[model samples]
Target: MPNLIAATYAPLQSNGTLQLNGIEYYTKYLTHNRIKGVFVNGSTGDFVSLSIQERKELLTAWHQNKPNGFQIINHVGHTSLPLAQELAAHSIGKADAISALAPYYYPITNNNLLIQYCKSIAEAAPELPFYYYHIPVLSKIQIDIVAFMKRAKTEIPNFAGLKFTENNLMGFTHCLHNSTDNQNIMFGVDEMFLPSLGSGAHSWVGSTYNQIAPLYQAIANSFTVGQHQKAASLQQKAIRFVEILVAYGSFLGVAKGLLDYLGLPLGPSRFPHTNLTTNVYSKIMRTLENEGIAPYLGNLP
Candidate 1:
């Protein structure tokens, strides 16, 4: 079975304080939905907006509260190499694996420099598996994954794979097919996951999995049974759901708001990401129910 790893949100209080209390419920919510693992401190967690201390605290809370058998892949990527190394070292024993994105401020256009950046972090957490988070749209360092894997093989001993977040399936496929080590290249685009599955992708990491695990799970089941039509229909619904929510406001904030309906109030999104007001959430919920997408959501407790 493919791994469903949720790129979790950083829970916050109304005043925008870190609400570690929410991790307990967050764990239960994901487990109930059959999510196998978590990708914390990534895009969904608003990592760029958070302080190092808050990120560490979030990691500590997740480490403390994560259910047995649940995997935690803490994202330790930072613009500062030293900070990234520090965060990686901090996850030594707590995280099941650690991942870092390419440096974005002064993007590493060269694959060799990217390898060096990853090497530094991987060495910091020598005991943990390391993944390079390859989201070029965000990092602006659109290097070839196959080349990165080739270099990583000889350079970084702890390199496990990539949190493959780009939409370039051709490159993604090459990484999967040509990798000498058979690394864990997790697909990251939530809306186009079915195509990735068609390409033999067995693991996925995305924010939508946090809310719509059952919908995607059903899609996977349909595909497994050779029900292509059913799977495609469900995939359309998944796509439509993203469209509807993204239309409301900041996609991340709107998604975080939906968590409240799932019985976990994750609070408002941080700066630059608009948090949905209660009225807005109510209207969105009503629209979802009207559109027949509410049944795919987690049950309200």
Candidate 2:
């Protein structure tokens, strides 16, 4: 079975305060949906908008509340290398694994500096496995991916794999093919989940999995059974599901609003990511129902 990890959101009150109280319900919701685990404090979590203290508090809350056997991947990436290392160290015993994207502001294109940044963090949390987040679009830290993966495995003692978020399937495939180690390459693209199957990706991470795992799970099942037409149909539905959320404003905020409708009520998002009104949520529901995508969203209590 393919592994699906939800890149979780930072639940906040309408006043924008941390909704740590919601962690239990969040855990139940994901587990009820059969999600394998969570990738916390990533892009979806609005990590940049959160303070270091808030991020630390979130990591602790998640670890304390996580269901047994569920992996907690803590994203420790920051523009400051020292702070990134501090987060990595802070995650000791709290995180099942630690991950970090490249420093975005004044991003480094040099593969050596990139590896060094990861190495410093990995060293700080020598006990936990480290994953390099490869979302160049956000990090602006593009290099020869195949080469970076090779060097990361060689250089970092605790290097596990990558959260391969980019669409460079050729590089992704090559890295997968040439690897003989235990290092993983968990794919992070939602639309390419089916295509990643072709590249031997057994693990995937995304936010849409929060609301529509069944739709994607159905896609995986269909493909496994040679049901190409049905699989494509479901994948298209998954894409449209995302499109509908995006059609509102910020996909993250609107998605959190969907969680509210589904019964979790995780609360509002921070600025620049606009949360929807109650009326707008009704409109989204109608649109989803009209598109036949409503049934796949499991209700959470």
Candidate 3:
């Protein structure tokens, strides 16, 4: 099966503290939904807002509770090289793989710095495969991903793949074309999953996979079996899901609210991400129901 890894949320209490006890439930939720893996401490997890200690705890909790064969890719990107390396080192045995992003605050002006940044982190966990998290919109270090990746294959031994969240299909295709036999280039745009499938992409990671994995899985299956029309319709439905959440202001904030409404209880978003009011969740559900998206959602509690 093509990998559908969820870029998981950081479950927190109403008071904004880590809900450490919820990891077990979270694991079963992903497994039950047919997801192949979890990408913890990534953009969806609000890694920048979390403390290093809290990230360690999240990693530990997921690693300890993960069922057999459930892959865990830990994101250890940070502004500080030492801290990023420390987190990467920490993931040596706890994570099935490790990924890192460039230092965003001091945006890398050159590809050399970016590759070196990733190279240093990869060195810390020689045992596990390393992926470069190429989320340029957030990282703002928009170097040529293809060129960097080519050099990285030679420069970083354990370099395994990339999590491409940018909207550049051209670059993604080139990266795909240039990928080594041992490497994977995981597409990160959930709404564009069908197009990715058409482009020969078999690996994906995203937040929507948490709620609508079954929907995407169907999309993949349809696309595979000469069901292009059916795949396109399902892709539209998946896009509608994102459109509805975006209509209500911050998508991240209302996203967790939707999870709560469905009984997953991911709790509120951290500061700046903006969680929707409980009163508004029902309206969101109504919108989803009216759009015929509720039918395709993965099983609810």
Best by lDDT: 3
TM-score of model 3 vs. true structure: 0.98
C-alpha root-mean-square deviation, candidate 1: 1.2
Q: Write the per-residue lDDT of candidate 2 for residues 2-111, one digit (tens) a residue.
A: 68999999988879999998898899888988899999999999999999999999999999998888999999999998999999999999999999999998978789
Which lDDT tens digits does candidate 3 get at residues 1-301? 5689999999999899999898888888888888899999999999999999999999999999999999999999999999999999999889999999889998898889888898999999999999999998999987888889989999999999899998888888999999988999999998889889878898999999988888998898898899999999999999999999998877777787788778887888898886777778788888888988888777853
Poorest 10 consecutive residues by lDDT, candidate 1: 292-301
How accurate locally is residue 31 in candidate 1, as Cα lDDT from 0 to 100? 88
The predicted structure with the larger lDDT, 2 or 3, is 3
Better of 1 and 3 by lDDT: 3
Q: What is the lDDT of candidate 3?
A: 0.90
Question: lDDT for every model?
Answer: 0.89, 0.89, 0.90
Overlapping backbone residue pairs in candidate 3 total 0
Local error of candidate 1 at 188, Å? 0.3
Question: What CA root-mean-square deviation does each model show from the true structure?
Answer: 1.2, 1.0, 1.0
lDDT by residue (tens digit), candidate 1, 232-270: 998988898899899988899889888875578788889
- Model 1 scores a TM of 0.97
